[model samples]
Target: MESIAIFVDVQNVYYTTRQAFGRRFDYNALWAKLSQSYRIDIARAYAISSTDPKQRQFHHILRGIGFNVQLKPFIQRLDGSAKGDWDVGLALDVYETANSVDRIVLISGDGDFQVLVERIQQRFNTKVTVAGVRSLTANNLIQAADDYIEIDSDLLIGQ
Candidate 1:
């Protein structure tokens, strides 16, 4: 079995799912399917800390389902624009753990990771899989991946 590490972008998934389907991603179902195919070495979910009780509860649930929830403080600028992203963090973690794993599964629609994906594939000879909402996923990112898993109804809650 391939040893796989999962990297999840919580903010991206939350907003994209709410925008695309008005429902949450079914993480439990995702875990079941992914764990079936690969030996999961580490599953990390990056999230911005919020005061919402429901969001906090959701994070707890993610932990129960075997994710290591990494939280960042929500930042609001003077111009009212908010800033909270985990691209660099995710990249660093993946790079640090690359040699130990055979596969890397990244869950995000952001295209900024295309280069990182390419590097991982080329340098480590690891299979890279991108999982994202189809409509929101970046074309370059998908093209760069060794495999792509669309976050369709089967991966969403309440299909």
Candidate 2:
């Protein structure tokens, strides 16, 4: 069995799915589907920390599904802007883990990850699968991935 690593951009997926389908991404469903074929070695979900009870519950659910939920403080800017992104941290972790795993699965629609995907493929020769809402996902990111998984009804809650 090939070892695989999974990375989820929690905020990106959350917003994209809500905006595109008005539904939530089903982490449990994703885990079930992947476990059937891959030896999952590392599964991490990057998210912004919040004190909301609902957010806490969501994180707990992710943990129950076998993910190590990494949280960064949500920043509120003086200019009414907010900043909380895991691009750098996620990329670093993926680069470090790429050599050890045969495949990597990244769940996000962020175009910023295009470079990371390309680099991982070139440096580690590992297969990279990207999962994101088709209409919202960036063309460059999708093109860079070794395989692209569309976040359709099958991966959405209440579908």
Give the best candidate by TM-score.
2
Model 1 TM-score on a 0 to 1 scale = 0.96
Regions of model 1 farther than 4 Å from truth: none
TM-score to true structure, per model = 0.96, 0.97
Q: Which parts of model 2 are misplaced by more than 4 Å?
A: none
Model 2 Cα lDDT, one tens digit per residue, 1-159: 889999999989999999999999999999999999999999999999999999999999999999999999999999999999998999899999999999999999999999999998998899999999999999999999999999999999995
Model 1, residue 28: C-alpha shift (Å): 0.2
Q: After superposition, how far is residue 148 of candidate 2 from its true place, in Å?
A: 0.8
Mark the 10 consecutive residues where model 1 has the least summed lDDT.
Answer: 150-159
Shift of residue 46 alpha carbon in model 2, Å: 0.2
Tens-digit lDDT string for candidate 1 (24-71): 899998899998999999999999888999989998999999999999
